[model samples]
Target: MRLGNVSLPVLASAVLCLGALISPAHAVPSQPWYLAAFDHVMRVLVNNEAPAVQMASGSAEQQNNVDPAYYSRVTKEAGTITLRGNVPSDGDLKVLQGVAAAIAPGASVVDRTRINPGVPNRDVWLAAMTFALRQMGKLNTGSASLRNAAITIEGVTNADDDFAVIQKKVREEAPKGLNLQVALKPHDVRPFVWLAQLQQGAVHLSGHVPSEQDKVIFGHAQVLFQNLTINSSMEVAKGEPKGWIEATKVSLEMLSLLYSGSVAISDKVVKIDGIYSSPAMVDLLKVYSKRLPEGFTLETSILEPVARAPAARAEDMSFAAHQARASYNP
Candidate 1:
């Protein structure tokens, strides 16, 4: 009969048996044929079919041979939610489907996940899965992913309230064992631009500030540049990036340390240029930049050293003194 499907363990055992009969001590070549055959087969199996072959071996130890983790992903778009990846058991798969259904009511829920019993932490994995679904459910169109122990949730939405819900979930409800990443952006596809310049004890703020954050940002500027006029030309608007407020606050803190400089924020990038007096200011900027929230980039160029006037020579000082005495006597 023709071979339909061959289990990796069975195939390995057959190879080992054949090797036993082939008596490697009597072989002429330096490398025995059976060892070579076994190695090649193992390499192919491990690379290509480790998961399925290991599961099919029907041994508890063999089932745990591969990675002791599960991969689960969920995506929501166009009124449909799709689930794909691996779960520990059929019960867990049903639980995931139930979560998807509960999160997106009236939306179609599709399950395409498999049951893999090698999951390391079932409770933590399920918590992560549910967290992802809840985050995605708040977005107009979004995707949530769980790979091993990392969970990523990304979405685009028009309402700030919806974004707030996602932020709240991440802050208060994230699972203990999994790493969570948020990449939520506004549905409005417009570039966000913010500019601030400090000159002669006055700071001019312009460009886009979130509607809800205008007062706080302006007040923060006033506090950072104490006793300086806060001239705001910024217009309140939406579509700011996830870390817009935090990044803006950090940028303003950096600008406050400058003698005369300007900071510009374009989309997710903050560009700072100006002059500073002390090297300590640069070190402080480096320290504050680290506090800028994730997903934002900082670029700085500040002038330094505070150009000094030249010293007068001794002869010139004596000549000036003599001239002053002559004028006074006259």
Candidate 2:
């Protein structure tokens, strides 16, 4: 007999099997749509352990499979959108560039389509993208990857409320039997610093510093140099110097204004070795020297800032200023 123009026994059996498979799996008729990838991506969102803190860029690798399709969905929140490998027309990437552009007007969209055929887990491709998009929308940072129908979602977030929403949505959107991995880190907002050092013509700031103090130091430099290239090796850590915040600011200012010099501060010491910008700066430091925080001692040279003339033999402040220094024995 003719069944929808396909004709006979072959058509009947194919139709029967198709109906059976599609009932729970939602299999596609035109192409191989695997549920594994979709399930994997969905499961991670709702998974118990996948939550994070603050706002950091998330990443995912589309890999490891019996036969994996190289498709990835990345929502870089005001950064860029990246799509890689061969994605089905119905895949999440099909219209993702447009959608991403709409959401982040300046975000870049990169397409790297290298389709690998025979992937039966293609069905979940869109689900994976949608999941990533939702997570990114809430977390403002997230990534998704689908390989051999497996899904991975990752992000960094700070709000417990948002984490809860992500958890709920993940569970609700993800179907069962998914291979999902959720990687999220919690945000920590504590103040800390270790070493802040500036030297030569360039400012080299290393170690760690409290967020607030970091702002003052860097901010002051910005105002003075206008175009300063700071070699920053500092990080936000868990503690601060005995009285490091104010001392750090003064240290930075002294370095930025000097013709060429170095300033280094730690828990135990605040040492400066440089030529002062002017006699007034040296006086200024002497005036406020006592105002430096309690954690560190200040050790520096003193000299009148003389410029447009010559590079003096040594960077120490002028002898006249030194003789007048409060510590002078003579």
Candidate 3:
């Protein structure tokens, strides 16, 4: 065909046409499927409160069941994602399923790490945890009512074997009389002789029982611990924690909004204002506190509901069906 002043040579045209007919079509570019799948998995894990997600430093393995079309490539390792709270085995399995469904639907564990079986001296362990939790800002320091309070340890188990191993390891690592017990125990079953819950917040503290031996050992050592107590709390005048959404709008991001407000700390309530963010959005704030005497262990599992953005709604999926129909049509 001739257009303007240029004409296509018959031989060249024929060769071009033949090449188009014989060569395979290029594949469509897809968003990194594994990233989306992993993101979803992480969201579920975080929502369910996992302590950690251990991955190889740079493994490129992707869960099989997630839709490969949403991501371009998967990282070999997602890194270890630690959950702030304890995750039940059943809950963990559900998260695994959620990840599988996003990538390879039928994929099963290729390899796995067995749960560690060990128990530490409950009294000693609780004391250590109490000390650590207090340092982490989870427990409150003042409040006479909280003193001598009874606390129930939930979510985590105190295994016999684990305790034995810890004791053995401590003895082996430290000189004799160095592994001192710091946790206070009552004559009764309760391990804490002096523990108090915040009347209005998530913070709790064990009564201070000065041990001369513990003072001697810890006086000059540099040790760190995880603090898992609620630092403050806030009241919701309009929005609630359940209203948090994964969007930019203030209405959609209620948690972030609430966190920006003032935190009121008192005997009746301790309000904490803080930010919560993920890869998709930024500057999320939330107000949370634990209800205790109701439960213990410092880490309160506040059940909050989440909202979805209208733009991200799954109902707006008709275009995908139309595209599939057009592609499949004869």
Off by over 4 Å in 2: 1-201, 211-216, 302-330
Q: Judged by TM-score relative to the true structure, which candidate is superior, 2 or 3?
A: 2
How large an RMSD does model 3 have?
A: 31.0
> Global lDDT for candidate 3?
0.25
Candidate 1, superposed: residue stretches over 4 Å from native: 1-69, 158-165, 189-330
The top-ranked prediction according to TM-score is 1
TM values, all candidates? 0.43, 0.35, 0.13
Q: Residue 305: error of model 3 in Å?
A: 23
> What are the per-residue Cα lDDT tens digits for candidate 3 across 1-330?
432454535434554565456424432235333334444554544465333333332234333322322111011112111112212234443453344333433333222312211211223323332322222121111100001112221111121123223333433432232233322211111221222122222332222222222232122111110222333111111111221110111211232222111212122222232222242323233222222222222221122223655343223223432332243211
Per-residue error for 204 in candidate 2, Å, reads 2.3
Q: Model 1 — TM-score against the truth?
A: 0.43
Candidate 3 TM-score, true structure as reference:
0.13
Taken over the whole model, the C-alpha lDDT of each candidate is 0.74, 0.54, 0.25
Clashes of each: 0, 20, 47
